[model samples]
Every structure is written in C-alpha cells, then in structure tokens.
Target: MSGKGGDVRELLAQYVTNLEDDVFAIQNLQGVVGAVMARYSRAETGLRETLLREFVKEDKLKLAKAYKLIERVLIAYGDDSVGELEGAHLSFENISMLATKVIEHRRIGGSPIEQSTRYVRYDFKDPERGYHYYCPESLKDTPGEAVFRDRMDRMFANYGRMWQPLNQWLERHKPVEEAVYDLGDMGSTYADMADDKARKVFERTYRNDLKTKACDILRSFLPLATRANVGLFGNGRFFQHLISKMMTAPLAEASHLGRRAFEELTKVIPHYVKRARLLDYTAANERQMRRLVPRLVPELCRSGRDSGIQLLRPDFENMAGALAGDGPVSAQRLSEVWADEEECGFLASLLFTYVRAPFEVIRQRVRRMSREQRLEIYDTYYGERVTRRDRPERGIEFGYPYTFDLVTEWAVYKDLMRHRMGSIQFQALVPDMGFHMPGELEEAGLGDIARETVALAEELFAYLDAHHPTEREYAFLQGHKMRWLLGMNDRALMHMLELRTTPQGHPNYRRTSQKMHDLAVSLYPDRARRMNFVNHDPVFWSRSDSEARQRLKEQALEGDETAS
Candidate 1:
C-alpha cells in the first residue's frame, strides 16, 4: 500500500516492492526486522551497534541472515508471537457467496472487504466459464452436473428477465432526482452535486440507484453460487488459524482454497505459517462431535414461526416464575434478566471484578446487604481510577447479554452476520418456508415472475435433495427466507443497530435493524434513553449524495483545487 506525497507516505511507512510473480517479506524496516526486533529487545548491545550489525543497509537487513534468525527463533523455539509481528494481504476473486461466509466469519485478527451486491451487477456470464456462478469441482462429470448447470442457467435467466420491467416501473414511480448544477462554496452537503463535474456524477448515481433497486428484487432469483470478490488483510497468526480451520472445513472447496491460500502466503512469509496443517486430533474430534450432535424436535425449534424477530433470552413468562421464587429454579439462570436496573448496574460494577458465584445468587445476596456495604465495595474498587480509560469493568459485558431468534431475509442475514460481535447461527438455505416480496417488485407487476422463480427453485432443490442435497444450498436466492439466532451484549447490539439503520443502509437491513431496536427497547425500557442514535427516517436519493461527498473528499485529498 505504498503511495507518494500523501497521508501514507507522510507517516514514514514503506511497503515491500514487488514485480509480477514476485512476493517477498520485509527484511527490515528502520533497520529492524521482525526476527531481529525480538533479539534487539533482549540484547545487551546498544541500539546503534545492533543496527549496524543486523542491517545490510540503513533501513534493511540481509535476506539470508534474516531468514536464518527467524528460522532459529520462530520455527525451532516454537515462538508463535513472533509470527504475529508480520502481516499479509490476500484476495479471493470470483468466489462463491457460500464460501465467502466461511472466511468472513472470523471475529478477530482480520479485516475483509467484499464487493457489495448493492453496487455490482450479477447478471453477466463469464466469457470463459459461461456463467456467473461457481460449478463445484466435485459435481463435475456427475449426472447432477447437467441438472445443476441447467437450473442455474434458468435462475440467472429469470433474474435477467425481471430486470427490464422492474427498472421501467422504477423510472415511472420515481422520476428524475433533484440535481445541483453548481457547487458554490463546497460547504453544503445537500446541494446535491455542487459543481458541473460532480453534477454528472450525481446523475449517474441516480441512474445506478434504479439498477440497485432492480438488483435487490431480482437478486432473490439468483442462487447462492453467485460469485463475488473479497480481500482479507491479517497477520501471520490470523492466517495460521484461518488456514488450519479452512483445511478441515466439510466442503471440499473450502479445503482446496485453504491449501491454495497457504501456498501463496508461503512465498512471502514462510516460517510464520509453517505449522498451519490439518491435525489428526482436530479432524477426529470434529467427526465424533458430528455424530454426537443431537437434532431436537424440528417442530419445537419452529415454534413462533412466520414472525421476523423473537426475543429468546428473556422469555419473561417462562422465566418470571422461575426467577420469582415460586419454583426450585428461582435462584438460577444466567442472570440474563434482572429485577432492578440501577442495582444490577451498581452491583454489576461494584463486585464485577470478583464475586465468582452465580449472578442470580449474587443478586439475592445483594438484597440482604446494605447500601453502605455496596458503596464501600464500589468505592474501594474504582476509587483509584484517574482517567476515562479506567472504563467500566467487564461485568456489564457479561451481565447484559441478549439473544434473539429471527426469521430474516437471506440478504439481510448476510449483511448482519458480517458483524461478528455476536454468536450467530443459521439453518441450511431452503426455499420451502416462505420468501420476501419486495413491495416495489410487486407494484412493478413482476410478482408472478418472482413467485415462479421461487417455485422453480423449490422444484430444483427437491430434485437435488434426491441427487445432491448439499449442492441444493447453491439454489437459495438472496430474498429467500432463513432463520438466524443471534446473541450479543448491549454495546455490540447497539453498535450493529445504529450502523445498519443509517439512511444509506439497504432497506432490507434497515427494517430489520429498526425491529431489533424496538424489541430490545421494549424489553429494557431504560436502554431507550441512550438508544436515540438509532435512525428511523427515510431519505430518498441518499446514496447519491453520499457518493458525491466521497468523490469530493477524495478530490480534495488529491489536491484538486476545483473540488472545494
């Protein structure tokens, strides 16, 4: 990521230079390699002397010596932290949506950016492959291959067929967007596109908005095998764990891609990821767990079906009695719910760092204690706090975790799952239950076509059930319905809701975020005070303005005087 005379270069950061088919590690930066940095910290020699002895140049090291040092200290001594010092960038192009989920599920140590369906058109066929979806390497040459190919071709064809009517209807329903012919002082965000150049961009943004809407509705007709690109950036430690996990994934594609990633990364950072292998114990344990995993009665799991969101953690009716002392389990539960918000907050903060007993037990004891005792505990614990960074302890985090069982659209679930602050799980993508009918799509008079697509999808999925069951998931459309369960603390919950409910958020997810906020607020009324940041208003032509602003900001950064 090297660039000249910009924020990146100003920071004195340098990137490894490379040519085609060439990838290499950073021998050193500022005369300190990752390998020597470890020894440099522990060495008796002075910094100046260490620099001269370790470096082949003022800011680099001899490649052979650096390799030897890393091999001896990192590989032989089994020092894993040394691997974390170096990072790498990896990108996967034209990967199936199903496979992208497995890689993007990592909660930490990596950041990824995937091409958004909101912005990109998925209707085109690859010139070489003849389709926009991935055909499994395993399914090739089998009887199912012809069936899979035929069905996918029909799915994308239906996707294309619906586009024309949807777009024409959108043009009629929402005509020309308001335009800004001039950018006077560059202070106004709304004045649509300010200057003439930006005006052209804003016009294009309006046109693309129609495309986005049509894509959203028709996306339901495309299958999960739709291919998109993703780029991931992480340290060696992150890749090591990811490589090991993917190598053991049940999907053959996952295992093959894992090997491919490891192979490419080895050329740049070899020793750091040397131990990323599929261990026998790990594979055997997974196999045993799969056998022991019990499937509860499906009907019970499907209770309260057809609804969008259901709060499961604080099932007040089922839990109110157990917690109110009428039953033997009154003094139990994970303290998912509390009687007094203030006291829960106080005790949760006071004895938060200690008190290793059950939370409900502690609350019962809190009822027996005096205010002075609680105050004394709190004061003793936090009295020495001198900065804002002395933030709240982890008790609130553990105390207020909430869970929801939601029947959300596949597209919304895809966006929401990218937020890994919570525990999220979903069932196999299936078309039987029901599907969403985007209002615009129905109004556009394409309702029959949408339903027909789902019917065809169900028919194909049924046939695959007999032939290739797992392969049937590739048949699920973006607007198809699936049940997802999510559990997270209040902080993470609020963050997800606020961010996803923005004016520019996809309508599918914005509605879901609003419902989540309403449910959570109704459950914990006190939380509503701080939850005012949630955006509930709709802004027509929102993305165009945002796009214009981003373009102008980039222009300003690039020293374009006309931008301002």
Candidate 2:
C-alpha cells in the first residue's frame, strides 16, 4: 500500500476505534462508512469479489448469506454502542485487514465508483430509466412514434455490430450456439447469471466499443437521473436518503417505484430499514412538552415563584413572614431568544435538512394530535388567508411551522406583494428549478418557469469534492419563499405545524416542520419554553371547533367509502 492508502487505513482504524456510542452508530457510522466504502470500492470488483468469496467461505454461507454476515460483523464492529466484545481484538484484525484492501483499491478521495457516461449511455433513451412510466410516446399507437425509437433502434443495431465480432471470437474457441445465447441482451444478460460469472463476463464485455455506444446515447438522450445510477451499489442508508426525499414528493411514478424499492429492500434487510414514522405536531403530548420544555425553553425556569419571585410558601394558611406569591407568569415564547432572521432561518433549514432522529422527535409531537385539535390549533395560530384552503385535514402537512407549503410561500408572498411588499422584497427566479415545483409549474413554459424561481442557495456540493472528492454527496438549498418564515411566531407556527406534521399534510411540509422543531430546540433552548395553546395543549386546541371537526370526519369517511 502507498503512504496515502496507509494513512486512510489508519484514519479508518481510529474512526472505528474511537466510535463513542454504539447506539448512535446503529445506522450513522455503519451507514456513512458503508456508503463511503461502497463508493470507494465500487470499481474494484476484483478486490470486492476476492473479499466476498473469502468472507463467505470463512462464514460458510451463500453469497447473500455471507454478505449479511459481513455486514453484521462490520456493523457490530463499527458500532461503538455495541460495547466491548470478548473477541474485540480478533474482530478488529479481520475488519482492519478488509479495510486495508478496500483503502488500497480506493480511487480519488477513496471511492472506486466509476464516472463514465459510456456503457449505460443508451439507458438514457430508455424512458423506464428515468422512472417515468407514462411517457406521451408510450400511449401513441405506432411503434416508431416514440421519440427515442429511432435512436434506440440505431443503438441496438450498433451494439449488435460491435458484439457480433466478440461473439464470433468466443465461438471460435467455444460453442457458437452457447455464445450466441449468452449475449441475449446487452445489459441485462448477466442479471440471470451468478455474481462471479456476471462480473467476469462484464469485465470483458464492457469494452471501449460498449462504453462508446453508451456515451453516444447518454450524451444525446438521457436525463441526468437516468445516467446517475450506473455501476452503483446503493446501501440501505443511501436508500433511506432517497426514500425520504421521494416519500412525499409529487412524481407519482418515481415515488411509487422508489417506495416499491424501499419495500423490497426492507424485506431483505428488515432490521436495517426504518419504516417512516408518522407525526402530528398540534396534538403533541403536554407531558412531553413539559419535559422537553426544559431543553427547549430553559428560560421558563425563572418565570414562576419557584423561579426567583417573592412567592409565599406558608407553613400555615396565614403565615406573617411568608414570601409573597407572584401569580402565574406567562410562558416565555421562542421570540425572546430567537427573534433574528438568521437564527430562525438557520433553524428552519435544519428542520428541513431531513436527518432522521431529530426529525422523528418533532414528528412524534405532531402525530399525537386528534383531528379536531389540529385545525383549531391552525385557526388560533395562523392568520386567516385564502391559502388556508390548501391545508389537509386529519394528517400532518409537510413544511409546517417553518413554511406551510412551498406553494403557500409563493401565495403568501403574492398576497404580500399585492399589498406592496414586493417593493421591499421582490421575488427572484431560479433557473432550471423545474423538478421541485412540478404540478404548479407544469403549465408554465418549462424554461420560463424555472427562470421564475430564484437560485439563492447554490448546492454546497462543491465543498464535498474539495474535502472528500472520492465521496458521493447530494445537497439542495431553500428557496426565498421557504426562507422567509424564520421569524414567524408561535401562533403562525402552531397552525403550520398542526397542518404539516400529519399524513394528510404535504410531505415537504412534514419534513420542514420537523426541521423547524429541531432548530427551535437546538438554537434557542432558553425562550421557546412552554406548553402553548396550539403546540402542546392539544386538548384545548381541539376544543375550539369540535363540530366542524365532526363534519370533517364524516366527509373523510364518505370520501374513503366512495374511493373504495
């Protein structure tokens, strides 16, 4: 191994050795390391195959079974939360040996994942590759009517020409019929083969010609998404990240496909996959509120007589020299500590950042609310507007608290502009921002619509390449519409949270609300203190409109039955 490879192995060793909490590593360490390892070793099929075979033989199991054992060993070893095992030294040696080979085989920043746009280039012309099943061409009557048919036909013909020679060459040495049968389909022929055989065949088959053909198709026809998944082995964590994004997203086909993938993966690795947790903010438990308040709003500690006030705690009912009771003090609101836009914005973004645990913590509070309590909380907290019509009943809406909805952000901004807020705060358009605002922007010229959204937040991905070039990273920025709600008070927030944190809520809203909750507690632990009317006190919040809620319940039941 070279000096740099040794350094990496050493770093990895220290990382595992120093991992503090095993439980913390339940998913994070194994996930990050596994992902990093996968990316780093992705191209090193030979090395990976060697390790897999050796590991499997040692574990005395089939490939899948051995893979699981290896995963278990790494997870247990990498996890600091597992406590010290009796055979820690022996296990470490084994893992270290594996890590060394992995590091030795690592490329750029260490990941061996390829970046060629060649072999799978033709895949871009495949509509199914984009995860969009309902192409306008698919429904057309004629076979040649599809936009990609001509290009695809040419690709197949070209590929056949290229592969024909190889097939003939193989036939000269072996059986011609078997060679002809073996190259059934260019890409998927190996799908039916064993991993070893597939690797060996593809290592030879994916020649310059194949890559050239792939690049030709990719550069011409494929969307970025279709070309992205080539030569990749996405681990559970990556899927978790992908699923989180797609869960509440609007792309019906992609989201459905992603969900199905998640379902299948969960079946294979049930212990590793975390099922989505449903949360409702308004119906949050007051007790948890009281407990979490200390962490959220420590300043509340000084608000009462027990806090430093001259409170009378008389032994007798009429004690002469007793401290005077300072009657109930108003709970300290989040604004006391976090009145600034920067702090609030930072928190808002954090909530939407989509880290799971913190997201779930806030989500649980939202999920506990009864249906009626949610709307009442909304009415009490939010300023009534036409956009209130968009709020989903019964389920938590995504993007609550921080911003009700991305659409709501635009609508609210438009309303503000109508009243002349535009002079002070004009909306800027972001170019090529079409993927996010699909339904809303579909009617607008795709390019023009993209131009309407301002690109205030550039992806921080460039930094990843600098510090860890070998690592794969993805990131996004909050638009101005969502960024402005940082300073919104508890009332505006309660309604937002109530709506967004439910299943019926928009997915982005749900994610955003959780982000806001996480930020609130993390940023200003002093002021955001008590069980407010809308947030913690679900009992009272729901009481405001019991009848309207009953009607909603009836309507929902009717709708459900009608759908059935």
Candidate 3:
C-alpha cells in the first residue's frame, strides 16, 4: 500500500530528534505508560470490552501489556532506535510496532504546538484562483412539433453556415473517414500540448476544419486556475516551515501559499505553529529591572532618608503609588531611582520597591560594601564587567566591570522582561550599548561563538559552586544546564525550584532559573518553598492522568538510580 499518510509521522519524528539524551527518552516513556495504565486500571472497565449479544466482556489486558512493553523498549533504546530498527532483520509487524511505540511516546509529553484559528484574521483569498462554475447542457422549449422543427431548422442553418468551408473541404478531400481522422488528430486541443509545434500542426491540419481548430485555440486560452489543488499536502509542519520561509520570498505565489498554510496550521498547534515572536528589548519592562535589583543599578539606593521606607512614613507613598499601576510594575522606573547617586543615602528608595523587606536589607548591606566585598559575597560569579565608583551623594556606584556576549545580553534582557519591570540604566560606551547585535553565526561572525563559549563557561563555573564536587562531578558533567544553577532567589526563586528544576523540565530557561533559586536559598535558607513548573504548551495537555503517574514512577526509579 502507498503510504500517503507517512507525512503525518514526520511530526512524531521531530519529537524523537529533540530527545537528545537516551535516558530522558526512556524515562519519559516509562512515565507515559505508567500514567496511562494507572488511569485505565482505576476505571470500572479500563481494558474490558463488552459483548452486546452475549452480555459478556473480553479483557484487552494483553494489548495494554504490548503497548507498555513497546513504550519501555523505545524509551530505553530511543536514541539508537531508528538505526537499530534499520539494521535489525525484524518482521514488518515488528517495525510497525516500533512506529506505534514512537507515536505513543510522542503522544505522552511530546506533541506539536497548538494554534488558535479565530484570533488570526486572514484576508487574501484571491479571486483569480478561487471557486468556479461549469455547465454541460442546455435545451430550448417549443409549443409544437412544427415550432420544434422550425427552431431545429434555424439552428442547423446557423451551424451549416459556420461549417460551410470545413464541410466543403471535407467532401472534396475524398474519404470522410480520412478527413475526420485528420481533424481528430489535431494536437492543439490537448491540454498538455502547449508548444508552438503542437499548435501549428493542429492549426494547419484542421485549417479547413473550423470546429477542430476553434477547439484547439480555445484550449490554448484556458485559464491557469483550472487546476486548483496543485501542491496541497498533509505535511503540516513542512507546510508551516515553508510558509514561514515564503512570507519573505519575492514570488507572490510563495508568499500567498506560506501565509495561507501558516494560518491554517495555527488552528491545530497553537503554541508552536505561529510566526516568529519578535521581542522588543527596549520596552519599559526590561529597563526597570536594574532599579528593583541593586545589582543591576549603578548606584545603590538606601531604605531611609531621601528614598525612605514608606512603612516609616505612610504619607510618603511614592514607592507604592508608583508601582500601583493598571498593568505590570515597571522595573526600569525602580532602576532609575536606584541608579541616581543621591538616592543611595536614603532607606525609602530601595525598601518599598520590593515585595519583601529582609531581601532589600541584604541588598543594601551588599551595596554599602566595596566592589571586592560584594564580589566576595556573590563568590565572584561574573560574566560581565566588575567595577565601583564613590558617589558623593549615593555612597558608591558598583558596575559590572566586563562586557558580556550578546547571548548573555539577550538572556538577561529576556529574564528582566519576564519580571515585567521598567527601571534600569545601561552604561554609556564608546560604542552604543543599546544598539543590538545578531545572536546567530549567520548574522554575526565567528567572534560571537568565542564570546558565547566564554559566557557559558562562566555560567557553568557559578553552577558548580554549591555542590560537593567529588560526589556530583560525574553526573554534573551530564547535568542539564539549569540543574547547575538551582536555589538562587527568594519566593520567586523558590517558585522555580518548585516548578522547573525537576528532572523533566525544559532545558533552556531551567539553568538560568536555577540561579535564581540559588539566590533565594541564600536569602532564606530556613523558609524556602518550592513550586511546580507546569508545561504550559498545549501539546502536553492531552496526556491522560495515568501517563503522568507512570512518568512519576519512572522519575522515582531514575532518582533512586541517581542516588545510588
């Protein structure tokens, strides 16, 4: 059988491609099966099918076992599966089972991003390539046989007039069959024959045959819209990727096709299937983070005096008043207050801007210390510049001494923006600091790779600080980038610790977030709380409860192994 639907399997393949670690693939599989089995077993007739006529039931327990076995095998050898299956002289049934295993694994925690249809408004449904109507027959009504005969006579008279030359030529040509064959053999009327030779042959051969030549000429003039579903296919991801590429293509067809496909696929994969979401780095939320966090500010503000705490003086509600907006609080505005040299002398400046007070006190204490002292406290985790300047009014202005790679810059910008603050100040440079650079090698040069490498090294060094290097070194080498930076903040840090630091977390943001968790632990070693980081992407939403449970079981097993 032709695998017309094989394209659908490619999406499943993409999920496997991302399972870079074989262990993760297996753990995820175990989790999926465990979760599914738990849920089904708990139900009244989890695997049992009812027989209507006999009023009996048959258990599908064996099928469920087969499914679990497939899930486990795929997870255990997932990274080597495609190759192993290729080399193994397995039966077609075995290969089919393997495919099913892959799809089943994908269904658990791996699926395509979901998209919304209603919100995306599409406008360009071109008229030149749209709905058309065709009619095959028409007839005339008459009062009587005489009337009908008269009409028929008129029609024949017109037809005879039209065909007079051709009819005369045919009669003169000798044999009717031969003349008819010559007329019928005209190639121009064939839809596929677009060449001038075909047109010329048909025209010359049928010149005396008016009807045939007319048909040939009409065929050449047929609208390009006659063929509608030209390149349509079921490969949505490929279609989506193509559409994304075509949006910028010079050809009208490419752009139109891309935009149409993108819009259509969005309905199915809402989270992952949309156009690129370009970030506005200069937005207020990003600018404000430096103000709220003392480390981000050039000049450290104090809790009392000019920037005094509101708790001591409720009449001075500027801090609370400033933050009480309809939308999110701006980190840039807070950074501006802290960045001012004169603002550092007061208690109110730094205190009220925070949700908690003790954290602010620790920050203020760090601010009062010299650059070296603050570095000593942070244990010297620096990717950027480290410097300090004595401020006549604000006490001191501590700055990041080293310039960071664009990756760090973008990463910091993304993090601060997520905080939704607006008060931060960047230092003036001989070259403009706010002017952005491309993050990718294609956009930048090899220099970016070097810078990124150094930055990543710095991040890993910071991550290794908390653990007993002797015991954890082996696993630490294989650690997800986020696992290195856990327990860096207060509640916000704890929130992530509770959420994303688990074994089955997203890889990108997890490390940076773990750094936040680390900071939290330092501030509140006694009262830290953790939160769960739920995968908000719609693709994971369809997983049954049992699958989730199985995942937990697998994680427990993995965790026990790790402990050993």
TM-score of each: 0.75, 0.24, 0.19
Give the residue spans of candidate 1 off by over 4 A. 1-32, 44-52, 55-60, 72-77, 177-202, 294-307, 314-400, 539-542, 550-564
Regions of model 3 farther than 4 Å from truth? 1-409, 412-416, 419-491, 502-508, 529-564
Q: Rank by TM-score, descending?
A: 1, 2, 3
Q: Write the per-residue lDDT of candidate 3 for residues 270-365, one digit (tens) a residue.
A: 222333221122122223433344553334333221111111112124445545663665688666544532232233222322212322343445
Model 3 TM-score (2 dp): 0.19
Clashing pairs in 1: 182-194, 183-194
lDDT of 1 by residue, 256-364 (tens): 8889999998988787778888744446543442332222112222222345676644234534654676445533352534544336444633342232222233345
Indicate the TM-score of model 1.
0.75
**Distance (Å) between predicted and true CA of 202, model 1?**
4.3
Clashes of 1: 2
lDDT of 3: 0.28
Taken over the whole model, the C-alpha lDDT of each candidate is 0.65, 0.30, 0.28
Please provide, for model 2 over 310-419, each residue's C-alpha lDDT reduced to its tens digit, 9 standing for 90 to 100: 11111232221122253433234323322322223233222222121122222333334454544444443232334322222211222223222122222222222111
Q: Which stretches of model 2 miss by more than 4 angstroms?
A: 1-115, 118-245, 274-341, 344-564
